[model samples]
Structures are given as C-alpha cells and as structure tokens.
Target: MDKHNYKSYRIEAENICVDYHGKVALYDANLRLKAGQICGLVGMNGAGKTTFFNALTGFVNISKGKIRINGESLRIAQKYQAIAYVPQSEGIDSQFPVSVWDVVMMGRYGSMNILRSPRESDIQAVKDAIDRVDLMELSSTPIGNLSGGQRKRTFLARAIAQRASILLLDEPFAGVDIRTEKLISELFIQFKNEGKTILLSTHDMIHVREFCDLVLLINKTVVAYGETSEVFTPENITSTFGGMSPDVLLGPES
Candidate 1:
C-alpha cells in the first residue's frame, strides 16, 4: 500500500492520562508506533499497561491529552474499525455456548453493513483468519472447550479477521502453554511482515526481548521508551520493576 493510502503513524498517544473512579491509572503517557513494527509495553502489575491500552483504543475515556490513529483523533465507536484489542481475559463464559467461528466472525461487525447480515465473503475471512492461527480444525468447536492457549488463538483469529491496521494485545500469552506462545509469536511476526502495527503489553520480558522491535517501560508513567536492548538494560529494568534485578527477570542476557 502507498504511504499516503495507508496511515503514516499507526497509532500515537500524546500526553494521555486516564483515571478510574477517583484514582489515576496512566499519567501523561506519550507513545508513537510506526507501521510494520511490533512493540512491547512492559511493567509490573498495576503499572497501568492495560489502562494505557484502554486509553489508546478509547475503551476508557481519557482524563487528559489526545490519542490519534493515522493522524486523526478516534472516537470510541470509530476506533473499532481501525484497531483490534485483545484483553487479558482467558475467554468469555464457556457455558454461553458460542461457537469459535461465530466469535471470530464478530470481528468483522465493525465494518459490516448493519442493515445487512454477514455474507459469504465474511465467512471466508473468518475461515482464513482461523487458518492463519492454525485453528482450522477446531473452528467448529465451542470456545469454552478449548484450552487457555487455544482460546488465545481464537481471539487472535478474531483480531486478524477484523483486518484492522493496528492491534493492541494485553498479556496475550498469559496462562497460555509454551507451544501456543511460540505460535502466537510467529503469527505476530507474520502480521508485522504484512505491515500491520502491533502493540502488546506483557510481563514476559524474554518474549519481549526476542520478538519486539521496540520497548516501552511503563510504571504508571513513561519510564523508558526506545529500542528493546537499550531499554531492557539492568539499570532501567531494575528501576522500572522496583529494584528487581534485571538478570533475574531478563534471564542472563543471551
């Protein structure tokens, strides 16, 4: 796609602050994500990673500052067409009796004509997304029947099917098996190769170091933001994680 045709900056968050109830979650966080890059947001628990994701996707109303996608500020409803967000939840209620394919099909609702039902092409896109995530065989199964990793893959398929330019994933690998994690990492690389910008928040420093092109360290604020190696240094990691040794968290550099 031509540079002018596609968005220049996949997503930009400028001086954004978010509050839940009376407490502040993210404070003046600024971020710039480019097309075709996979970036990681790392921080300890309660450090505002998810809150930042919510703010960027407009899921949570911002207390201050602005967020833009493709140079345009996005409203909550409008954001669904441009970005795909996968929260940390394992899966929706298993007893709800939703099929995996149906769940994936929901991703296309953002762009679908509300007056009309989904057509054959939409079904094909859902199938393609399931295949991309290697869930073709299980596409007919109940989402509740799948394992934690499989559930993650299902949501990833949904995001892929959305055909959004930007993806925001919150702890996607949490509770997932090692094999699923590897598969998800490979899928992320494929998305990057296709020029889709990806931003993910996780505590998995090892995967972040290995896969992310850029790293943003957050602790209710922007602590360090730059290349993965540079920001993952002992001092920076220690400071961000509250005096925890980087070696222990990063697992003895290469």
Candidate 2:
C-alpha cells in the first residue's frame, strides 16, 4: 500500500501475518485505526490478541503485509518513540526492584543524551505522568512491592511519560480493583478526547462495551470490526470466540 493511504489513519495494518517458526499466529490481519479512538482488540485465549499487539509494536516479525504508524514504517516510528507499549502487568517481573519513579523515568530515556541522563523536562514529564495516575504518594515505593492495581498504574505512568501518539495496552485492567479501573478508564477517555489512539487487548466485556469506540474481533484472524455499538453484539462475540458464550468471556455479565 502507498504511504499516502495511511495519512488519515494513526495506525494501519494491511494483510499482516506473523508466525513463530512456521506456526501461524496472525494471518492476513487488516486494521486501520484513527486518532481519538479507543479500540478494543477482543478474542479468546491464544486467539492472537497479544500477537496482534506485538505486531503493532514491531516486536515480532511479519512474514507478510505492511504496518504503518504515524504514516511511517513501524520501526521508524518506534525508533522515534512515536509508539508506547504496555504489556500485560502479569508478565512483568514485579521483583525487579525498581521504584515507581524509576520505572516511569525509563520512558524518558529515549529522549535523553548518550549517557541517558534525565533533564528537568524528563523529570517533570515523569512526575506529571505519575501524578496523573494518582501515584504521587507512592512514587518512591518499589514497584515490586505495590498491589496488583498499583503496578498496573506504574506501567501506565511509564507509557504516559512517553507522550506517544499511540498506546498499545495488553490486559492492563486485568485483576484491577474498581478504583484502579476507574482511574485507567478516565485516562483512556481523556487521551481519546485529546486525539490520541489507544488499542488494548482484553477479555473485559464491561470495558469493551462501556469505553471502546471501535472493536476488532479476531480468532487467529480478523473476524469482525467496526463501531463498538455496532459490532460488539452477542452474535459477533460468539462468532469471534468460536461459539463460546459472551458471558464466559468474563464470567456472566453481571
């Protein structure tokens, strides 16, 4: 596809396919996401949620197809730090012994000098991100020691500090409490209003129905995608999850 075709979209994936050692993960996945939109990437387990996110982050190789971010190659955008990725918190090493401040500060490293030192702006950015997530009081505490919710906020702050044009979040709200969920949702909405693009993968039907503007359902491939109000129905949900009840996706809708 031509680069000009990506002008109207914040991110675009055209026929993207990824495989690990010949085992297909994602096949011919196509999506175009615009700014100020929160897209929910939904599917059952091992159905390519994380694989799709990895494709966006350029962390995995694409056997075929193209991905453009900010109208540039994914690697170029990544090199300039135009994208931020917050992987599943459960996959993180909570015992890494880094403080909340330390974790957030790393986001600024991309803008630092050869020594990777922090300047006033970097410090201020980290501080602002931490404060925005309401982690100001625990800024000095070790991330490994925080509750599950706090840890999620800590990584989210890191992503915020980058001030990227797009954010790829993997199950960020999983295992979080109401307070944390509220804070995260608020931030997501705030960013969306600011014309930032956010795509998160999750099984949280509540979040999907309540917050997402767009929904992309994938069962190892693109099944359905459109406005959340339109494509997020039970029929599409069951089809995407291979006949599984939508309730089973997140334990019977309250």
Candidate 3:
C-alpha cells in the first residue's frame, strides 16, 4: 500500500481509464469528493457507472491513473480497508445460506488480523451497524428469506460495519419501494453527517436532486461534475444520455 501525507480530500481519482480486454470503458475520468458529501453517480445504462465503481473498488484494474483516500494512494490490496462497497441488489445471491448477522460480521472480518478472533470492539461495531439499519429483529434471519428492502438494509449494515471512510454504493434503490427508498436515503444522510464520503449510483434523478450535495454525470467519461444544482441540468442530462426524453429528464414541470 502506497502512502502519501496529502491533505483532506476524502476521495480522489485522477485521469482514470479502464479497459475491458482491448475495449475502453472509462476514459480520463477525474473526480474529487470531500468528506461529509453525498455525491450521486448518475448516467445512462451501459454508460460505465458500474465500471467506474469497479475501478475505484479495485475489482477491475485501471489501465491508467490513481485513486486516493484521505490523501493516501490507494492500492488494490488496501481497497478493502479503505472502502466499503454495496453492490446492486440483483447481485446478491438468493440461495446463499448466510444469515443477516453473519453477513454483517463479514464486514468486520477484513479488519481483524488473520487467525485471530473478532475483538469486543468488532462485535460491538457489528451490533451497532445492525441496529443502525433497524434490522435487529431480523439479524438472525437468513438473508435469502428477507424482503428486497430488508436485503438492501442488510448490505447497508454490512457497509456500516466495515466502517470505511469512503463508501461506494451501486444502485442501492433499484428494487425497493418508495418508502424503503426514503429509509435508505435517511441512512445516507446520517452517514454523511458523520463525515463519511459516499458515492452512490442511481437512476432516479429525483432522489439525486433531493439527497446529493454533488453529482457526477458520466457516459464512458465524465460529462459533468459539480454541485447537484449545476451539473444535473437538462442540457447536461441530454449531453450525458444522448438526448434522453425531455419528459423523463425534466419530469412534468419542464
């Protein structure tokens, strides 16, 4: 793990590019996020949102550029400790036998030394995370049997337990109801208030505008990035999505 004593940008990626085989997925992407900000990662389908997250999380090797957390250069091996990722719900295996508590505990497992049991602090963290997500009653439930919202909350609990300063969430509200969406949004707010830097991918512009302090608009590359009010305009949306329906982009008011 490379280290740099740089100053306080919580998350930064500079001139990032990723290649899948010989095909380019992202190009020259640069993003910097401060602590305590909820930034929305929004783009059309197949627009490399997931690819960018993968690159940031070290799941995919970046062909060029650097990612840093709290001023330290991020290495693939250090990604687990530096970031916690909540992937899309469909990615969760319905047939997996793990209980919710077990899944949440796995988050803390990375921070524990190898061959050593979890410390009291780790156990407490897991419990607090579970309670924070309002899943204490369902903690012992098999993850497979939980509802879509419950599953989403379970994974969120896992991320909270990881206690990483930076969280990368991919389509966290995809399958849940509006009520559940509101609940998750509140959790993000709480995390932001606590000074966690969060980057979440979502298709809902309404939610993006409502909760995100900053927004990154991308389509295989960065189209725009800045305060939500500035970057999420119809013009930028059109540019990013290749003229998506005005009705869809602007809603009824436009």
lDDT for each candidate structure = 0.85, 0.90, 0.87
Sort all candidates by TM-score, best to worst.
2, 3, 1
Q: Which candidate has the top score in lDDT?
A: 2
lDDT of 1 at 230: 77
Model 3, 179-204: lDDT tens digits are 77888888888888889999999988
Which pairs, if any, clash in model 3?
none
Which stretches of candidate 3 lie above 4 Å from their native place? Answer: 1-5, 76-80
lDDT of 3: 0.87
Worst 10 residues of 3 by lDDT: 1-10
Q: Could you give the C-alpha RMSD of every candidate to the true structure, in order shown? A: 2.9, 1.8, 2.6
Candidate whose TM-score is highest? 2
The segments of candidate 2 whose C-alpha lies over 4 angstroms from its true place after superposition are 1-5, 247-254
Q: Please provide, for model 1 over 103-156, each residue's C-alpha lDDT reduced to its tens digit, 9 standing for 90 to 100.
A: 899888877897537888898899999998889999889987888888888889
Question: Which is the better candidate, 1 or 2, if ranked by lDDT?
Answer: 2
Per-residue lDDT of 62 in model 1: 93
